[model samples]
Target chain A: MRWLRYLGYALGGILLAGCVAFLVAAWIYRDIPAGVLEAKYTTPASRFLNVDGVRIHYRDEGSGPPLVLIHANFASLLSWDDAVESLKNTHRVLRFDMTGHGLTGPDPSGDYSLERTVELTGRFVDALQLEHFSIGGTSLGGTVAMHYTATHPERVDRLILLSPGSLEGRSMQRAGRAVPKAADILKYIAPRALAEFMLTSRFGDPSRVTDKLIDQWYEMWMREGQRAAILARLRSYSSADIVKVTAAIRVPTLILWGEENPQAPVEQAAELRQMLGSAPGVTIITYPGVGHMAAEEAGPAIAKDIQTWLAAPTVRQKESVPP
Target chain B: MIAARPQLLSLLLLMAQAAAAQTQPAMDAKGWNLDTAPQSKTATPAEPPSTLNMRVYKDFDGRQQRIGDTSYAVDVSAVMTRCNDGSLIITALVIGGQLTPLDNHCPTTSK
Candidate 1:
């Protein structure tokens, strides 16, 4: 009877231990909603460039003149989803994720320089048989677009820059331009967590971040050779190149700014305006109460300006000019 | 034998309490403020306390993990409230620096 009592107590204790362990595990690995996780894994709109062996993820819907959209760092074609919807009816909009970004191929050549992006744009334009087009981009994309326009002035019609980061003088002053070097450290730590932190921090709202979102970025980061390409691009890229390209841009340029954007403050826009020297022709529009994503925050207004600016006589003249 | 068992049990209980205390980080007592009352499971922002900014942290096995990724939101209940001003001021809780109104948190009024 005493042995039976001891056995009962041991069994109860074991059951309790099992229950506790189960509870702790359940808390740690909470169920993720299927819809949310699946949504993150949906493949982006894609196109293959025969010349470069690059699978360019883009949204190319619309009718009128070609308008190419370029997104910022750590962003894919979806960043311009709002613009694509607004302009698809009137403009043949195009947006491609830069190499090492989104679903695009990580160029084995380790070439993510502004020149390579410009070259890829040229190839893509040629492949699509686009005679001339209006081009614009945000942040890093803006810099690439500017360089492309300046280098191949004949092919580009007009320019739209959204808080571009191209001031070499000031960029040099900032200590941590070592994006590539930092990437190595991030790689050693949890890559998914770091990417999530980097991306989530950029947004004005923290509540928007979700676990499934981090998982998708993690999958993308896991793509072989992608991290290397991203790091290489970071190490090789120079602000001086972008700054130098700005002066050579002869097309009608439109500068877009977000009032509360911490990344590219309004002061940078003011400086770009001063340096461009096309005060009347070069228009600077600000979206108050918006963050880095002004086009998204004020889509209709931006679309209207783009449509009008594209129709301007000078921009038209540049488009008609032979490449 | 009974006395010896009781003494052993007391010692074990004390050790367990010490372990628990050691593992748990000291809560910032001053920052404790009233969050909103419990709300339905509808998609809404996580209600925050007016007195203190409650950063979204995942307390897993007593470890605080910073949540990241701006793709979806987590659901939390604002069951507890701390006295602040005359009226309960409710701000949405944020995990990362970004804040969106999509988080689902139980409102303080639900109680």
Candidate 2:
């Protein structure tokens, strides 16, 4: 009887301890306030436009022909800050935080699918009343830009695909399977430490992962509705679906790649070129030692390339939609 | 009970490490070799002559047609800037040889 009583006491103690530990963890991993995040990330040029009930955060600067830039998944418009500064001198640049990212928060309808993103981008362009413009994006943003140009070729004067997403291929297929599972797990266990670690891993050089950058990324990830939105976007589409849509793009395309990109390997650049073989113009430039974050890593060089490409007599032509 | 407490503590530590590991890539080395390599540079074309003459023409059909010894096609309702080197930079719709900006009047709320 004494042994039985001791066993009961031990079990009760263990249960009480477990509850305390869980509560502590929850408190430690609590989301950062949106006000704090905005103070850190919102720049003087930061502006918001309501598209389909979603307020999009964007920056518009410079003068000359309009050039719209889209950021990668899990990133905001600020990711293109260096690139924007380099391009703004000679071009009218517009970069916006896509829905479910950065200051944009999340989609009101809880739909973060690529199709919905494409529709939102179309609406954004229409809202700006851009008769014709050049479009560019990095990673998932690259894929989004491709889809937008495919759907509205007459509106896109030129296209830039910077380390674009490729889910159909073998390397990306593996990433496609693993990323969603990780996001699913992360939705429930979103510790700031874990978020910071993930952001650091995206960079090829850990030294480039500054304390300020990590803090900004962690705060944005903890923003209201952002976690759920990111998870939904990860689970929304398949590699096969992306391949079907990408095969139809016919705009004059320039593909920039980081040779050492582990997430989206440099070999995928060749595949993208092949997929865009039918484009009126296809130019692929690979930075030898760079990695996944080329826009951030090699911003000035890329801006120069874009300016040169735009001025090239061979690439300059009136936009036309294919039959 | 004392033995179980140590075991439980170790288990919690292991779980935390595992969660941290999950956030990183599985590759052995995540760093890229950027220091040793020379940065890629884009070749810039020679600037056009500053004193070159400028001419413009009106294109009613929005086509790049040459007009009287000058290769200029002015799309109606478009803002066209003819460079000193005879290059054309268009910013808006060209309607009847006049530049018309797009009606982008969306309200912006500053953050």
Candidate 3:
């Protein structure tokens, strides 16, 4: 009889805890409607294009050679603000938030595969009537630009890869493996600290992760349907057969890496240079204290280097590539 | 016992964000705006509380919409960012009101 009483108490406690958790979440974490976030976070340079049914948020600045940049996973076009300012003065710099990220939110088609992202990129440039342009990306974006350049060699004049990711070894189901078992709970209860922690982890210098930056990131996460779209994208993540994909790139290539990049470390920079063997010319640069977000970490320096490389003739120009 | 950790963390984060949520960064800077764009092409731009470029789509989308018909589109938004003079310049960038062609989907609201 006493054991039965203990079981009843346990059940009651569990119910109470669940109720408290629910109430707490409800009070602090309501999804910020997309319209509200857009009005609050949209910058002076923001533009919206309804492409393939996805309202892609992007920026096109400067007025020379066109350069299209892609941001890293979980990040928006705002990540490249510093780099854009430096490059926009010379080349026509363009960058966009990937579907399911930033103001773009969820993709209406529900397709989050890498191939879809690449296709979206094609559609975007085609919409702009940009026949030819220099393509670049950071983190996940770097990987997409590489894939796009390989698939559409005619449209890409040069390729810039900054800490790109590859699913060469992750072709199988890798959902929620490194992720905590309680990952699903995250979709509903995203604490602001969690965002700060993630950004700080990615940054080489944690001190650089400012409160304002965290607010922007948190607000983006809070955007309506954004978190669900992000999780869906993660679950649907798969390789675009990136094995030996770099070898197919024949245009000039530039690879940038941060020495402290915990994810795609600087060591892989050498491997990337070797992989782009078919490229007419490859220049690889490594920043000492930079991390995965090199564009934001050392934007001006990267912009200066990119400007110089763009001006110089291609083909074995710099000895930066590892021999 | 372990379940309590996430709840505690959430409470702490809520407090932290509240403490950090001062509009000084927004007020000190220019403005913010995004898809608050008019659905009908012929609609007038809304007078926002703090949005900077809430005009005809003429920037990123390349003057896609003007005063009467088109506009622009860009993709960078930052709050509390100190400008060159370190002062926020929030104003409506109503370009030269250049008369651009209206999109087929966008009807002329000049009636």
Candidate 4:
């Protein structure tokens, strides 16, 4: 009886210590920047598209030619809302929530890799029946677009990347090197609350965090098996196996970066330019005072540059589609 | 004032268009200017039609495209320069007519 009493006290002490450590670590971890998620644009055309069994919510409006825009991780189609509306009067813009983020429900299979996203983009284009189109993406999406262009140059007329995930395959390899295997499990423990903490830290300015946006993000986090999907994505990121696909991109690529983008600094963009050196025409543009959210922070400026770059009217012309 | 004349005129035109468009909720003036092309719901397997139309709103210096007011509704792609801060705006909105400017006109009040 005495021994059992002592064992119980020992277990209680261990539990108490673990709780204290977790609370303290949580407080310290709170310092990391979380991303701002929301439908910030005033555009009413934002809707969802059911493509490949995923209800991809997108912002589709405007008039002229077609331009498909892809957003980075932890972002939705709303990230491109400002740029889309600004250019919609003269250009038709397509911006959608990728498989895992935004209103687009989580992928039940948890296949959020760049290759999968590239396939999804192709399906999106096919679904729209766009034979040839100009495409641009930011962060993770940029890497996927670059890969897609390399593999299916026939489909992509022009490509633009904004602070793409990794300009060089080595960066991804390096990122994969440090991925924590069990860290993702923490993503599921009290997920809704933890996600709030994690996402809020992605932003430099916490004031950008809004109630509506937080609610939306929380809802998405709690969606069917989202925690598992996030874990799967983390596992994919840690695999560090993005070389063969990225090494083969051959399209005209434009790499844009924010001078202050911390996640993917200017060096990464330079590395991307170096890797795709064999491409016909690859241009790298950098802006000052911009961060990971360069498109949103400098949406107006980024949009204008893209318009000019696409209009240079110098790329190899393909057979015109039937009018 | 003459140098400012074009900008003032442009602003007024934009404001008037915005106001008129606001009046007729069902009818959109911007898309109206686009070619009356037929749109089908079924996805086309063939090459997409060249509905590409490019428009450039040059900066006040007449060097680069103007920002803020530039439309992605027409061009296959566009570059805009913000008139106020003079920043470069790169956009891929024109390629497949994916631009949506609806949010710019909405109220700040959440729906």
Instruction: Find the 10 residues in a row with the least total lDDT in model 3 chain A.
Output: A314-323
Worst 10 residues of 1 chain A by lDDT: A314-323
Candidate 1 docks with a DockQ of 0.01
Question: Which residue runs does candidate 2 get wrong by more than 4 Å?
Answer: A1-5, A168-185, A316-323, B1-111
Number of the top lDDT candidate: 3
Candidate 1 residue-wise lDDT, B1-111, digit = tens: 011133322322332232222333222222211121122222112221111111122221222222331122122211111111122222222112222222222344421
A1-323: candidate 3 lDDT, tens digit per residue: 99999999999999999999887996688788999988987877788998999999988788999999999888888888888888998899888889988899989898988889999999999999999999999888987898899999999998888888763224233433443447777677889999888888888888878898788888998888888788877776755566568769989877666667787756565456545646665555555566777777778767766776687655432111001
Q: Write the per-residue lDDT of candidate 4 for residues A200-286, one digit (tens) a residue.
A: 554434455556655555655544455556556655652133445555666666667666566776556534543453454554455
TM-score ranking from best candidate downward: 3, 2, 4, 1
Reported per model, the fraction of native interface contacts reproduced equals: 0.00, 0.01, 0.00, 0.01
What TM-score does candidate 3 get on C-alpha atoms? 0.70
Between which residue pairs do clashes occur in model 2?
B75-B94, B76-B94, B76-B95, B76-B96, B77-B93, B77-B94, B77-B95, B78-B93, B78-B94, B78-B99
Q: Order the candidates by lDDT, highest first — what do you get? A: 3, 2, 4, 1
lDDT of 2 by residue, B38-65 (tens): 1223212432111111122322233434
Q: What global local distance difference test value does model 3 have? A: 0.64
Model 1: lDDT of residue B15? 25
Angstrom error at residue B89, model 2: 29
Worst 10 residues of 2 chain A by lDDT: A314-323
